[model samples]
Target chain A: MAETAVAVHAPGAGEIARKRPYIPVFVILAVVTGIELAITQPGLPEIEHSLRIIVLVILSTIKASLVIAYYMHLRYEPRWLALIPLAGLALVAVLVTALTATVAHP
Target chain B: MAHPDSVDEGGEEHHGSPWPVVIAVGMGIGYVGIVSASIPILVVGAAVFAAGAGGWVHVDMERPSRAFYGLAAAIESRFPRVSARKLALWLFLVTEIMFFSAIIGASWTLRLRTTTPGAAFQAPWARPGEILNVLLTGANTFILICSSVTMVEALAAIERGDQRKVRYFLLATLLLGITFLSIQAFEYQKLYFGDGLTFTQVPAHASEVNKLYGPTFYAQTGVHGSHVTAGVLALAYVTRKAFKGGFTKDNHEAVELVGLYWHFVDVVWIFLFTIVYLI
Candidate 1:
């Protein structure tokens, strides 16, 4: 039940697990999310449609990169590891573009 | 003892949790019930699912199962390539991206085509903050963001061998996940019962808007909610293992992977908020 404690200082592994300041990133996320909400109010439907889509997509990408880099330890792992998931993403992009095009026309 | 420091491919044993199977059975039955329109079967399925989930949690709380310590990790070096799991997850995410793109793209297409007057089945998109409780959902979004931070911090703590912080951050993340879901449940309750949104029907007063709103709302949010639920279950298992002294600075891959999943879920929500509520 206390695997976290074990992982923390397990005899000789503490060198890897250390603390860092994450508050700033959290703050950025909060501010961006707030902006997303603010710009999406009713009176600005015309403005909300395109602008909201762009900002939200950007914000989510940023958030995903942070998690992948820090939490998933992709930064520390062999660089080759990154390519594995990237390949998957590339395929997904193709699928999406194809499907979206079909939906739009059909 | 096997050289404790020497990393083996399969360093630990994974006694897979039975709860997942139980939950699956419950869902299967519930699905059948829905199709059959059998109230008792549905209720029974739900009860079994709940019981299985409760038992699984109880088991996890008891202790982390022994690690499988599969030799796959050692064998991974033979390929001298990208770690298999990381590659697999990325591939999975890519598919997920497409899945979401389809949903969002379809919605956008509807918004554009229908907004034109006299178009077949013409109706306007819901204005921002018109149908949704924007402020409340925004707050929930904020909560999800915080959980993402906590999840990353937990991984960082594991990296530094700070067991206490790892536990603290993971626990914090678990709570934040619950809070976000609670807010969503509240939102759904208000929308379905209070605001008259249902799967196949819209409120009497909402005719000016496209009828697609109900299905879209449920599709996007329902999928996200299921992801949150999965994250919660993963956290619970990891937390139990943390309590059992399972992970070590060198062997905490489980925590990191789960954090990745949690973050991915958060990323999904960020887009979801934008598309469903904001746009």
Candidate 2:
């Protein structure tokens, strides 16, 4: 009887496994893009130049994270797989640093 | 030939093919042409590459099941279950990260140096939203994001062995990708001819903007647009295969692999939209 019951439960398990939070993620992405467009429009509270830049950077980062973690299925993949891109980002960091230094002094 | 060596009863290893070599050689030639700035040499390389690619795609579509499927299945049994193709693609993506970094970093450096007071360049970067069709590009960004969702769903559908849904979703993804490229082409046309942003020029109204702006904008977004064009071609290939009932639940690595590339493009655009448009 237990074996038969286990067989009966197996079909439902497949459904549970395939479920992913895709639509909610899309909603969040669209909403964020809307906010990005809104915040950059011509007439608003004159945000400090630096603060506006910071906010845009942060928002873009959040949007990027959502797409990578969800759309790319990186969240579900092995954690070590992320190290590949991070390796390239390590170089990017150096480039950004060098560029900033040049800009500050040049 | 279904010879014993190529066909393991267990279907494990692939003595892959030589066509990829031809493709690589063509790309190598193209790279050389780029360095030399010779249009004829570049065109020849591109033609050869296209032929090689077309032949490879033809072979895959004709016999997608036997060699590729067995290889994918054999390699998927190991840790993480990613096929060798997927691993190779991820590695390729890493290189793309560095490539984009170079383009974007150089552009940003140029912008900064030009705009800085007492700097060498004559003018600043045009202000945000000044010379760009931000609203149109923003809509294009949304289109790309939507395509990403459709692409993921196509993979999901294939995983479920729903061939109809796979075909539908792939077709949807292909259409969305084409829409993106069309909008980009339109934007390029407008920016170049209508708005006076060409290789060595900017709008007269924005005469204070640096001359480097046009080249940098085209370089960053042009490379990205080319990537999207490649993605669309990939999508078309897979969509054709999916329509032919080529992928089943147990053997759809092509779908997944294409999804990986598509999503990677979306990820790049996510940042590109911010860096180029909003910032």
Candidate 3:
């Protein structure tokens, strides 16, 4: 009776019990961070400045997405809940665009 | 009538408190004070905010950290449901996303405008590792990432009713969070005093760097450090409660909420380490 009550009130409790790739995600984040440091080091074969920036941004985005998807459990959550952060990102896109325009023109 | 804090059929407590409103009022006043540059008003706002936080903590300290899903169920029967607190937390995170964006956006704008030629403050930006300690901050980033793993592991432990593992993981996470903050504090001290990176001036070593560099660097990393401090405090609270057995397998939403916040902070640092340090 108690178990049924809990299951009714708390949906997805079982799904959360399933094992996740916490260690693997951590390894990816750490490795990517190391790559970021390596690429930016002064003695490394000088990558073009613009290319470095693009690569760093892509790498950081990957790290952020992994953290959000696994550590924050957005991947396991209801699809709609993911929309909350995406909505914020949409606004961020707008802001970045505006800021980019300002910098390009001025 | 049933007492307002009475338990329902599912053994969930139902109650309302005024502390959230008080906190909001305090924050509203604090925002006003900031805009107007009123010191006394700001102090008053801080006092109110502190009081509200203290009162809420005191009220909740003895209660088991439980989920309130009654309203969620009644409101939505067709769609998949989440706990009210979790939904609210995600919404709060959305606002945080916008908040950090604005801060980063403004800093980037300043950097672009001042560093470009024929601009009002045309000065060169500092090269990577010229004025800052990227190596030290990179290590701190690793510490934060470790904390995120422990935080999730803690949640996973509690979900399995492994009370001992939950306590141990929470303790480990708390220690890792404290270490991250300590490293950041050390970095800030060294940067501010040893390197002369003040709000108004660049490091003496990097004299040719734009004056705005100091302010922008501190603003971005300092704001992030402040968020980490808040995360540490939240972790401390949850850790204390977990030690007191204030959570159970079915009623550990607080752990998940705090984990979400901790990971969010970690996610922010991933970008910040790249943007502020590596780039």
Candidate 4:
């Protein structure tokens, strides 16, 4: 089906078609979600307390980067374009730092 | 179909459209109404907003959605270039990141401070799966993830100029989005009424939970849910456009932009599910 679509929708001269592994990515996401649920299940705490959080955060970040880079096509667009989101994240870093300080003092 | 930038005879730039300005005016009126606490003013603003939105949709449905090759598109006339509209959307998303950060960050800080020893918040925090329906929301998260997949596939289809696949994938994405919202509505109904987790009410059986829990939960998830609703509406619009032969290989920028927003919403949920539901 993908081959058919790509052939029929053939891009004009300079337009590059994205050939991402859409289904595989979906499978990976589903698997990761399953793992997250499994780790948190009432009886099964395979991961430790503090490390559990780091694991979940890492998994979630991986999923988000997959969506942003592949699905959002940021990887394919001009590199400078990524600076926009990075700038947002930079401010967010400040926000998190200040927020961390508040949490500490509170 | 040639590249959008290629030369063609008499390619006079599109003049302009009035719908955007009208919508802005409506939003301005709505803002004033909100500030003044006037129901009539709010209703009037909403009416104007609806009328403007309908007018715009009607106008757009009449023709294939095209790149606005007008004065505003000139912003892209530089080097290492990106389309002006795409750049604008990216910048818009940057603000959205901070917006969600503020919401989630405040909730996190509140949770931390309240949980600390001898603070104003007296009630113990709800256990991981005590009151909230984690399984249902996990399923909802999966639905959102699937919707993100279909959305990107729809863009891929259009990029290849496969109109049929484009239409079907779009319709699938639209339905998936609707399914996600429907599940969320169901979850909300169960929590608010059946489980007694209301704006101002909490169940007697779960009285140990902090009062702030209900409100902060609603505020954070509610905001993100509203975004999903908006994304669903956009999907519906794009699906209709796909069916009407409104996009082609040469001019499918709308699909990409809409997909960007949809994927961003999914990205937001990725963190939200971890923060709100898991941890």
Candidate 5:
């Protein structure tokens, strides 16, 4: 009699056909980077310094999120795994707040 | 075909390896050497670290990489089943997140303090493109983003058991990583020697800039450049292993793990380009 074996199944051709949109993500990343470069051009119309900073930060954050989600496969992982990075971000928040507070009041 | 190396219901047996402990000991000694500023001790520590790393790689290269799920079958059912190695890698990445945050945060603080009005060191910060070559670095940034794409595609290819595509994609990623580093090295040389952007001094043309500008810029970007170098080395290893047929459709966790690190580095550059270059 053959013994029953438990194994992780590799994805089949059908599953492979349903690949994640890595190319689309790459295109988005490249486009956003281009936008970032365009807005920060030396000869461009002068945006407010603070406003330019805000726009750049938002754009970069979007790019970073896309890479993390699709390229790093975080979006496909179990939900709990995200909590690990979220915990790290929480510490970063505290650190940033403290640093800003110190600079403000010093 | 079912995976030949799958764990049985009783749980897989794990062999202990001493290389990791050796690596840790070597790093600890290296840290002590740095703290004490002793060249001889540092050299010794580095030698030991290299030996440990070589041993680990040699050992690992001999066999196809295996995924180890640490918990027993019954307990594993109670929790989401993640490979033990992958869990450890995620935990390591979290520490990396904190590490980079501290470095960038300190640089920002220095920038804020020195550039503020009525502060002792009241020189203004350099506007965008005043000193550094934004166009060149922007192109380098694109190269890094391309590498990230190839990295993911490599993992995707291996998951489908397409060995040829895996080799090609991994080679592309490794080349792209090398290109990114080469561009960075060229930029660093040009900035430091041609443009006078040393750690202690700014370019003569930028006399009104804060003295801290050079230090902060180098501190933030230098550490990031070092990380890219490390990532390139890791990419080379994985590329070679892929060519050697060390990984399979089911045993390509190393590819995925390295891709995670590579993408993380690209993510860091996304923000770094904004913070250090654009802003």
Candidate 6:
């Protein structure tokens, strides 16, 4: 059925119709999520709670990047477009850091 | 059919859809229903919303409408490089980031302050898998991750002008999204009624587990679940559009944008599952 749809709407001139090389990215995401889950187990009794929190945050950032770059098509878009979301992340960093510090001491 | 951008295409057929207006009205009604807190009104609003959404998809599936608005021209205009739609999406995402951060930050602050020993007033944070169903939600996390894969593939299929693959992948994503929501509903029932974790009320026989559990549980998962619901609705709309053949190789910005939002939602859930369930 999908083949029929593709056949019917043949690619227009100058339009890029290449297959996205995405399977490897999915594999990486799965591996990262698995690692994230494994690190949370109680078996790592020696690790401090704060370090665990840091690890989880870092893992989440990596996963978010994968989705933004590939699924969001940021890599295919113009380079300047990247700055828009980066601004959001910068704001988030300032907010989280400030809030975390204040809460920690207060 | 020749490209819509052809030089002599000024008189080409216009397939302008009316569903956008219908959607706006439905949303207006739904907001009114929410404010009124009337069950009947809410149901009516939801019906209107669903019908508008269904009609929109129905129109989208028919054919790809051509446009002379070249990407270069789009970028060169007032806002230029990024289209208005793309800009709006970015702004919306920024707000979403803040929204999730607020929830995650509040939960973290609560956990940190509560777990402090002999602090003025402190309640111990629940350890991993203590008062919640962590493994079940973990599995749900994986389910969401799989949906993201299908979603990305659907976008790819559209890009390749492979409508058949697009439809199949979209249908798969929709099914996965529905399954995720169903599991969430089941989880909510078990937690709220069976295990005594209500939004405001805790069970009478509750321990310290019942004290602060309500806030954190709802804050973390509630926000995430709402996002999942939104994604599910979007998935349904896009799937219906796919069935009607709404997208083509070069004119499917809507599908791509929706896919971006869905993937972002999946990423948010991944982190939520880690913080709320695993940690």
lDDT (Cα, tens digit) per residue for candidate 4, span A1-106:
2223223334451345554778888998999999888788798745676798899999999999988988898887767789889999999999999999988876
lDDT of 5 by residue, B171-232 (tens): 99999999998998899899899989888899999978888888888888888889999898
lDDT of each: 0.71, 0.80, 0.86, 0.81, 0.83, 0.74
Better of 2 and 3 by DockQ: 3
The alpha-carbon deviation from the true structure for residue B90 of candidate 3, after best TM-score superposition, in angstroms, is 0.7
Q: Per-residue lDDT for B161-201 in model 4, tens only?
A: 78999999989888988998898889889888898998766
CA lDDT for candidate 6: 0.74
Q: How would you encode candidate 5's per-residue C-alpha lDDT over A6-36 as one tens digit per residue?
A: 1442446227535789899989999999999
DockQ ranking, high to low: 3, 5, 4, 1, 2, 6
Fraction of the true interface contacts (Cα pairs closer than 8 Å across chains) found in each model: 0.47, 0.51, 0.69, 0.66, 0.62, 0.30
State the displacement of the C-alpha of residue B156, model 4, in Å, after optimal TM-score superposition.
1.0
Candidate 3, CAPRI quality class derived from DockQ: medium
Error of 5 at B135 (Å): 0.7
Worst 10 residues of 1 chain B by lDDT: B63-72
* Model 5 ranges off by over 4 Å: A1-6, A9-17, B1-13, B72-75
Q: Return the TM-score for candidate 5, rounded to 2 decimals.
A: 0.93
Candidate 6 iRMSD, 1 decimal: 6.6
Q: Which scores higher on DockQ, 1 or 2?
A: 1
Positional deviation of residue A6's Cα in model 3 after best superposition, in angstroms: 4.0
Against the native chain B, each candidate's TM-score is 0.75, 0.90, 0.93, 0.91, 0.93, 0.78
Candidate 3 wrong stretches, greater than 4 Å = A1-5, A9-18, B1-12, B75-77
How good is the docking of model 4, by CAPRI class? acceptable
How much does each candidate deviate at the interface, measured as C-alpha RMSD after superposition? 5.8, 7.1, 2.6, 6.4, 3.8, 6.6
lDDT of candidate 1 over B1-279, digit per residue (tens): 223333335454344667889999999999999999999999999998999988876664544332222333455555433334545666677677667767766666666666666677777777767777889988898888888888888777776667898898889999999998898999899889998888766776675778878888888888889989999989988876776666655567678668878888887787788778876
Q: DockQ, per-model, please?
A: 0.36, 0.35, 0.61, 0.42, 0.53, 0.29
By lDDT, the candidates rank as 3, 5, 4, 2, 6, 1
Which candidate comes out best when scored by DockQ? Answer: 3
lDDT of model 4 at position B222:
95
